[model samples]
Target: MRRGTGRRAMAYAAVVVGLALSGCSSGGGESADESAAPTVTQTVTETASPTETSTSPTTQTPSGSITPTAGAPAVDGPVVAQDQLSSPSGNIWCSLEYGIECEVKESSYQPLPKPADCRLDWADNQFRVDRSTGARGICRGDVTFTEQPPELTYGTTSVVGDRACQSTETAMTCWDTGSGHGFRVSRDDYQLF
Candidate 1:
């Protein structure tokens, strides 16, 4: 009987010591429950009133940036077409321009080595082949081409008139009816038709 009682006492003492050690083992003296407490986060946003007219310059955001220029005139005419041009050295040039803006790109490319010109006559709503040489092509009006970013997955096909565009997570392709004059926008490089 004495030996059994001594063993029982020793077991009880061992349990008590184990409990005490566990209580102190928590780091920074924080309880286990306190350490596992959930954290809360708050986000705040500000909006301007309709009556407010901000004179401050435009600011850029993390996703994208657009700065308003003082002397830049507002773009006129609807966007009719888009084109992506690629070079033999694997350089990509993409442009999404309105009918009037296409003329600007065409005249601007006159001095450049690459054929970056996309001339459009907004008055006639026609795509011009070569403004300097007076070549004419198709006519498109108010047809918008939304560019698909490389990160987006390409699913299904979006066709417009004689054009078809397909997008993948890493690549996008827009082509004419015959796949003759088109381009592919990819994460690695742009392929022109």
Candidate 2:
């Protein structure tokens, strides 16, 4: 009878150990499945606020058009009208009231010969000033004037001016008040002043 009781107790302990091991194994399997399961992830994007965007100033064009925060230099002087260009030398006149003048010259100092065929022709804001060597013609564009002359590129040359000029979508114009020397180009109709 005593041997039989010991065998029964040993059997019960074995059964308990087997159950505990099975439970642990099952728990590990569940944990592995949870780890392998797909997880939901989210992403977010942010945009700048108006106040943050407005840190830079706005630029206004000669045509009364406003470009928002382009960071372009502001025009220091008033804009001259297209029809107002005039020169004291009667060669080219952009605007006398605006103090903008253009003249044809042989060199930096020498004026173009009399009857200098210095004339301005334009299509919209785009213009070509025809003149003798060193002669410049002044004209205005549809865009607003800036302190810095707007970039007026012609062929391989990048036109720059000492005086004020404005840039537009179609074209740019400069007063060329300093040297009075026009731009040199192969074409008879080229942007100079």
lDDT of 2 by residue, 40-156 (tens): 111101111112334568754443431222222234444433333322222222322333333222122322232334353322222233222233332333322222222222211
Q: What's the lDDT of the predicted structure labeled candidate 1?
A: 0.32
lDDT accuracy of residue 15 in candidate 2? 54
C-alpha RMSD values across all candidates: 21.8, 22.4
Q: Relative to the true structure, how large is the alpha-carbon lDDT of every model?
A: 0.32, 0.32
Stretches off by above 4 angstroms in model 1 are 1-153
Cα displacement (angstroms), candidate 1, residue 106, comes to 22
Per-residue lDDT for 111 in model 1? 27
Native-to-model Cα distance after best TM-score fit, residue 11 in candidate 1, in Å: 99
lDDT of 1 by residue, 117-186 (tens): 5354232211222212212233334433244212212253333343334444444444444223444444
Question: Top model by TM-score, which number?
Answer: 1
Q: Runs in model 2 with CA error above 4 Å?
A: 1-63, 66-74, 88-91, 94-106, 109-193
**Model 1 residue 86 lDDT score:** 22
